[model samples]
Target: MRLPPTFYPALHDRVRIALDRAGLDALLLDDPLDVAYLTGFAHFPNERPVAAWVPRDGEVLLLVPDLEREYALDQRAAARLVVYPEFPGERGPFTVLADAVAGAVRRVGHAPSTSTGRVAALAAAFPGVEPVTSDLVGRLRLRKTPEEITLHTEAARIADAMLAEGARLVAAATGPDDLPTETELAGHVTRFGTAMMYAEHDDVVVVPMLTGGLVYGGANSAQPHRLPTADRLRRGEPFMLSLGCAVGGRFVESERTFLLGEPTAEQRRYYQVVREAQETGTEALRPGVRCVDANRTCLDVIRRAGLARFLRHRQGHGIGLGFHEPPWVADGDETVLEPGMVLSSEPGLYVPGHAGYRISDTVLVTAAGPRRLTGYPRDLDDIVIGA
Candidate 1:
């Protein structure tokens, strides 16, 4: 799922338009992800600073340490390579970067994530130029391009396979003593998903570092953010598995709560309510719908069950290059859902000392309607293990 070389050129054209509208003569970017997004150059981000300089009417420049010069050129990045000695050298990288853009830009722009020291350095570079905050790149990333959607779809497939494998592992336990501990289950599931990703994709440079899962069983499942522990899963209890993977920098998640053994009326009731709420919230995501309204739709379902008191979080949030981004599906957010926007649909209920039930999927808002990118079953029969 490697983006074609032409992708950056088109992205550059879009940035130029954005720069014109922002009245910025140039954009000074030091964040690794932002640099990678615009220049098609992904590197090991560390304390050693790497930056991308894009001027309104000229070629892009990349400031890097001498060590990364060959690597940057090897990637065939669509930018002019500008190398410095190293970080904190006799002359710092920022000093060198300032020299590169000294006379070219008058009103320089930076992202909100930029450090205050970095902004100050840019201001000192040239007395005539002023540095100001700008969200030109962040705004451009809210909507997914067709190619990005393809990568997210592929990531979703891997997430689905991992979840199915996890269910099979739980089903293999013939008795309570045969069950695996939470840490063991989480580790094995993550390794299996990472292996599957490597076997399927030949375009990856590094290992799939973002493929992993968290397993919480029994009482621990009652906490929405609980980490995997050494507790063994017991029959007649609930276990929650949250799994995700990334492909081409795009991410997708698939999560489910499973009942280890046959029915307890309360367990069945909680699972059904959560599943219904998830479906309702996912369907409510349509073009022109406000983010708050989508969240309210899920809350309405939980309220009907008289379980609103157990609600611990919002319905979902945006997903893409980053795991969580803007246009959050929560209260006080008035962002309107539009075509090409992708979000996570998770409606959950957590009751301390009892159990928790939740189901999550990555969904895409399309012109026709909402499309579920992760195609794992949500039915109660399909999720119950070793029943």
Candidate 2:
């Protein structure tokens, strides 16, 4: 996805700022998302050893595989593109990457410890070069830019459209003794929602997750995935749908629970608790507030509702290029919320014999307050699929 014109410049400024704070001459970014964030080129990192070397001054250098030279050049106008052929025997992309890093600065900061092998190889090649850990580079990317917020807002709009279509399909399919299989219903929703996003042709849709019934409840209780099954929708069963979509490498996440039929008293109470907890968490989002307070707010709501034991996970997490990012909304995280920070407020409750209800939405921290990107209704009354 091609980023907005302001994105790369803002990213460059952020990198320079980070470099100054970390006392590094330059930073070597090898991760695909990091490279795209800095250089505005999005491609599979595994295809080539692509790296972005950003100096405290001067233009950034994008070292890419020979095959992707043209594509990289077309995508990134600000960065000087350097191409290297396939690695020869005993010589890997690290050689070219090291040369690129050496050309940028004397001391280089590596992104993650996983890049240690590449860092060691570069140090071996350039005996005098120093490699330092600079995770702060990623920390700098935790907050979004105005342009990023726009892109993410567009992504959220697409997600909201998907939810609307899914809801309509569910309502239409529901009738007296006219239940559909989980796979069938999920396939319809996924096809429609994915098509709506892909029609824009600006961003690709990740795998859509739709699961239903007791099996789905168990799977969601364990973890989230996209493997919907053939379980037929029945009366009083709960189904959960989670979605993640990206635009220009920026991601938005949303999830909602739906009841197949009229919920029982216990189920209604549980859903109310989950919804209230989510509301509490979302309301707590604002600039300068501690991230952990959001989690505490939601947990406190759940605990007061007498379902604390069913709460199995933290309130939410940071949302950006990746679905799950840093600066978690959990206890002990003292990171103050900033105006551009985006987060998901997903507080869930799962009981062994009862049901699971989770509500999630991507929220952007704004000067006024937290603005929810997804517009689907969060009320329990609106959560029922059909009568």
Candidate 3:
């Protein structure tokens, strides 16, 4: 799907304003998403590194490897395209990259010097050129535009539908009868997530977390993937699943915990605490509220519930093109909650032997408090799979 032409102009304007503020003549973007944001061209950065050099007042120039020249041209990503072909034994890709940078910027300002080593290499090419590492571009990206919010809302809808269907899949399965092993369950969840993304017209679906049972629990759960096992779905076992997918380069995250059967008193208590904490966090999301304040709301609830130590990670993070971004809902983040900022409010309590519960949802900061994008039941009663 092609993004609106105004999107690139708006992005260029933001960069130009930021550059003027920082006294920069040009901003060189080597990050794929950053490039795509400024140039509407989405290509693999690993295979062939591409850079978009946006001048403060002129046209944008896209420099790409010769093999990717046609792809860049097809996208019409830039006013001028500089293609460096691979001569069997000539200078490397850096030569083409350095020339492109020199041609675009008389003097560099607010150029990205991280991510790819090329950022620093380009700086070294010009002896007197000043290389500045300013996050102005990133800061500009923190807030979503109206169009971006629309795509995110659609992504959230897709995620919500998948999680709801996945819940039903778990509820209908009985141990050794209709239930699959942990490995099988993980595969099923991954497949279901991918299918849902395709159904929603998304080209790619990144099925991050799909695991089951305590076999692969430990710190591995923090990572996206855990190997599924053959452990049967016992009557009262707690199953946790977290999934994230992107639509049109915008991302959304959703997590759900299901109980195979009725929960014990202890399980019910823990789940209730987590749910309350999640609610507290979500309630705290509003325009003008500090990011840390929302996190404290959830943290305070967890501490009062006597599960502070088990709260390993931050309350949540900003959700956008990347799964994890800035304006983190943690203790020290002072970024004010502004309208158009979308974030995840996930408060989880994990205990090794007993149980773990996480209630998460995508929230958009709006004029009237925060709008919940993912509509799923958060109550403990709603989490139970089967009787």
Q: Is candidate 2 or candidate 3 better by TM-score?
A: 2
lDDT of each: 0.86, 0.74, 0.71
Better of 1 and 3 by lDDT: 1
Question: Model 3 segments beyond 4 Å from truth?
Answer: 73-79, 86-89, 92-94, 97-106, 110-116, 200-232
Residues 1-387, model 2: lDDT tens digits: 446677677778878887888888888778876777777777765645778878888778887778888877666545888777885426676566556553445677888843666777667766677888778667877888777888788778766666676667667764645666656666665666567666766535232231111224323333444366766666667777666567666778768888867778877898888888888889999898898887898889999987787877888899887788878999989889988899999998887655578888999999999999987898878888665
Q: Candidate 1 — which residues are off by over 4 angstroms?
A: 70-76, 205-208
Clashes of 3: 1
Count clashing residue pairs in model 2.
0
lDDT of 1 by residue, 4-91 (tens): 7778888888999899988999898887778877776778887778889988888889989999899888777678888899777888
Sliding window of 10 residues with minimal summed lDDT for model 2? 206-215
Q: Write out the backbone clash pairs for model 2.
A: none
Error of 2 at 335 (Å): 0.9
Query: What is the model-wide C-alpha lDDT for candidate 1?
Result: 0.86
Best by lDDT: 1
Evaluate model 2: give its lDDT. Answer: 0.74
Candidate 1 TM-score, C-alpha based: 0.95
